[model samples]
Target: MVQQTDLAIAPRTAMGRAVKHLRQQGIIPANIYGHGQPSVAVQVDALAFDRLRRAKNTRNFLTLRMPDGPNQTALVRHVQSDAISGQTLHIDFFRVDLQERLAVKIPLKVTGESYAVKNLDGVLLHLLDALEVECKAEEMVEYIDVDISSLNEMDDIIHAKDIKLPANYTLATDPEEPVIKVSPPRAAALPEEEVQVAAPEAGTPEQTPIAGE
Candidate 1:
């Protein structure tokens, strides 16, 4: 639900050393392509891109203000990172139509401690972390919350259709997907049995000594 201001970018950023120079200046070199339009290389301010990432609508459409032509509204389709520095080195922007639906992946955040872990002495296990959804680009969500307070048994499972998602969004993952499960604590180790001791040799040292003598 967060909003970001228009991002300013340069129109013509060429290949090879020129793009490397862009990265050297704390500016991330990127490309915007989609809606069947030709791809164009661009340079976005690193500081500004960081702000947009923290704005809670990172995967959604953003208003990109190019240098020359009309400002294009784009969906942040792909982002490439520098392997060593972990910086945003490249990005792909997709031109979007506001009314059109886009399939995107949404994160699932689990909340609340189960009584199965407290009163019943059990452990909580979460199976699924993120799920895919189909919705309007503008309706995309940052994350979904799944509450586990209602779980009380060892076999309790939280299903996709059970937890609530954004009304504007539709779950693309199967409804039977298990998000979380509660199980009883591990069983105590069993006591080891005493092993039987073997009898000594029938012949004694005295017999060997007498025979040698």
Candidate 2:
């Protein structure tokens, strides 16, 4: 279910310097590869591509509907950017096989504070930013959400084993991966004993101490 937006962009036809000019106008030249069909060169809105790339839900699973041909169910496989302006230079869209399981990295979304952090004043530490998974095209999720409301102790760590994964989705990452944990935050400055005292006890018995002695 692709949400329709006015973010339409015409495909790019020019190459070399011409393409560079198009990119300067906030348009990105790209290509779509699908279903044994020859890859087609397309132009995407530079702003639109940037927005879609950062979208929380469609960041991973997105299908592009071509005006001339059939809809391309695809994922962004690669992206190139301008060195100075940081604008997108090109993007690669890979056609998806609905029946095949694809392995992709999806971001990890954590919601709700752990009880340990709330009651014990501990900090919630996130270990994993994303996880790889094997899933069919339709079952591909943009992200994996881990709920931390169950954590109840200072050392409570929520590992991959504790994740409530979606149906038909299997973890392709290490099972023992630590996703989140609760630990006390470090003080900005060390306590008295934690700080290193002056070696040689300052001037103790040394040549004379500075005038401030």
TM-score of each: 0.76, 0.76
Q: Show where candidate 2 strays beyond 4 Å.
A: 1-11, 34-37, 50-60, 188-191, 194-213
- The candidate 1 region of ten consecutive residues with least summed lDDT is 204-213
lDDT of 2 by residue, 14-72 (tens): 88778878876877888878678898888887777777667633355456766665665
Q: C-alpha displacement of 119 in model 2, angstroms?
A: 1.1
Q: Note the clash tally of each candidate.
A: 0, 2
Candidate 1, superposed: residue stretches over 4 Å from native: 1-5, 54-57, 186-213
Candidate no. 1 TM-score: 0.76
lDDT of model 2, residue 134: 80
Please give the distance, in angstroms, between residue 135's alpha carbon in candidate 2 and its true position after superposition: 0.8
Give the Cα-based TM-score of candidate 2 against the true structure: 0.76
